[model samples]
Structures are given as structure tokens and as C-alpha cells.
Target: MATEHGIPKLRIVEPSFDSPLTSVIIDLEKLRDNRLDSKTHPGIFFQIKHIFQLLESLGSARIEGNNTTIAELVEKEISGSRNDDEIIGDDEINEIRNAERAMDFIESRIKNNSKIDQAFILNLHKIVVE
Candidate 1:
């Protein structure tokens, strides 16, 4: 391609349009170099659509919210059982039981509220990305 100074810019070959969006690899540097300030670029538009599609795809792995479960709390209890001896006294056991109750409450909310899973996953995303 011709440049501003009439020099040739390297031609970047386009990938097949037949492939899925998941197969597309975005060039963040090239995108930011030109697109960070440009509003009308299809690159940014498609990327956002791609991201939204990905987030929507998460609904696929979703558990049936119709069931009652505090899987996280249950998992915590199971994990804690692995180191059972670490709890030395009746007081500590009571504390652990209290924690378990709190987890159960959170789990109940997760099971009942339709929006809870999305928020939980979003929080998980923030934690992971941060």
C-alpha cells in the first residue's frame, strides 16, 4: 500500500472470511496504532461484537439455575475437609461452621437470583484480569 510520504507500506494479507470469529486473531498493536482514536473503524466494532459474543457464549457453560445448590460453599467444605486437623478447638470449629453458613447464604442467593451468576462471573473476570 502507498504511504503518506509516497513510500510503500507492507500489505497485510487478510484471513479467510469463511472462518469463525473465534478463529480470528486481532492485532492489538496495529489496532491501537490506528484505531485507538478512530471511531468509525470496523476493527473496533467487530472486536466489540466478538467480545460480546464471547461473553454470551458463557451462557452455554451455565448450570441450570432451577436447581438449588451452593456448589462453591460445598466445594469449600470439601476442600476444608482435606485439612481437617488444622482446626484445633471447639471455638475454631464454630468459626468454620459460621463461615460455612455464610457460604450457604451466598449459594442460596446464587441459586435463586437469575442475575447472580453473571455478577459472580464478572467479578471473577475482574479478579482474573486485574
Candidate 2:
């Protein structure tokens, strides 16, 4: 049913196993369960995770019109040089950094058994904005 503002209210419904969508979901779950384990070392795993997080952050920034490229970001990271003559602006860099920080906050706060609630979402939003 629509609200007074004419926006339809969302309703939660139970999943039906006989639906085609349900079969696709089951197939995806099976694929996830059968995926091969990398068995990577903890140190290596962290390194990989950091790389992926950086990529995710950069992608987020790009979506928001931050024109920083992955190569430029990686160069800045590796060189550790924050000179005045840098190709990318500080704002762009900060946008990406903020996204990365938000991702880290999510990782730190969430776990396998954790329930994501409104408070957690608001806190996460604060982190991204601040």
C-alpha cells in the first residue's frame, strides 16, 4: 500500500522454493559452497584484502565523479609523495581515503554473527561524511 506521500510501502514476503528465482539462488549458494579455498597465508591474505579494498574505494570515488585513476592512486601510494605538483587533487584523494576508511570501519564492526541495525548504519554514514 502507498503512503500519504504516494510512495509505495515496502512489504517483506516469504521466499517460495518453487520459483525460478529460488532455483537460481540455490545454484549460487551451491557455487559458493563448492568454491576452491585459496589457503593463503594470513599476511598474504591481508595484503590481498588491502588491495581489493583500495580498488573498491577508488571505484566508489569514481562513481561520485572523483576523476582519480587507479594507476595514479597506486603511484601516489607507492611513492609516499604528497607534493604540491601532484596530478590528482587532494579532494579526490580524500574522497577515496574516506571511502577506504568507511570500508575499514564496516569490516571492524561486522562479523559472521553480527546483526546490522539502524545505529550501525548511522554510525557508518557519520564515518563516511566526517
Candidate 3:
């Protein structure tokens, strides 16, 4: 740590060359590669992946205090239909839809072998934000 012009600057810690965590990282990578081979079972993998994306979208909405449920989200996603009895707001529904579309874009890019660079991320962010 150092001070410059009466402002304290924190020291940055550099990572070590080797550590016990390296083995864990390697094992996790192997597991990920083995299990995430969508080519092996494209149909089931995409279905499960879509479910996970929906759950992730739901979690994001919940973090923002949106009370939209998975069932409601799926119903809206499937048919764009909303029940008159349900009092969910348009903002909540839109947030869920935005996340779903963002995830879909990412999936599409991956399927198309598109590079996940800064430009790609910015494009995805644009889709999600607007």
C-alpha cells in the first residue's frame, strides 16, 4: 500500500505460479468438457439448457424483487398469453423476456461458432437492454 496526494492506493496481489487449487481447476474443466458435449445428445441437452436458462432468468427477476413465477414465465414464453386473474406487471414480464432473449442470443452465437469477443458481448448486451 502507498499514499499519493493524501490518497491511499491498495497493493495488487499477483497470482502464484502453482497451487493446490490447480488440480481442482483441472478436474472441474474435465468434468465440464465431458458433460457439456451437446453434440452427444443435442435434443436432450438443448432442452435441459433451455430449462436452466429459464431458471436463471427467473432468478435474475427474483433478485430484482419481481414475483413472477416459472409457470407464469413459461406460459408467457410459450403463447405470449397472460391470465387476467394474475396481477403481474408488464415490467416484470419484460425483464424475464429480455433475459430469455439474451440467453438465446448467446446460445445462437455458440451454435454459429461466433467468437465471444467484446463486440459480441456488446451486441448481446444491446439485445438484453433494449
Q: RMSD to native for every prediction?
A: 19.5, 5.1, 6.8
Error of 2 at 58 (Å): 0.8
For each candidate, what TM-score against the reference?
0.21, 0.69, 0.61
Top-lDDT structure, candidate number:
2
User: What would the per-residue lDDT of candidate 2 be over residues 1-130, giving only the tens digit for each residue?
Assistant: 6675675676776579898888888889889768567879879998998899999999988988889998888887888764433434478887777778788778877745456776888888886765
Q: Per-residue lDDT of 41-121 in model 1, one digit per residue for the tens?
A: 788887776445433323322332222233532454467552433443434233434333344445566768646555765
Model 1 accuracy (lDDT, Cα): 0.46
- Please say which candidate is ahead in lDDT: 1 or 3: 3
lDDT of 2: 0.78
Clashing pairs in 2: none
lDDT of 3 by residue, 54-126 (tens): 7998998799898998877887867846443343558788777677788888888998999987699899888
Error of 1 at 28 (Å): 20
* Model 3: per-residue Cα lDDT at residue 96: 75
lDDT against true structure, model 3: 0.77
Model 1 TM-score, 2 decimals? 0.21
**Which pairs clash (backbone N, Cα, C closer than 3 Å) in model 1?**
none
- Give each model's whole-structure lDDT: 0.46, 0.78, 0.77
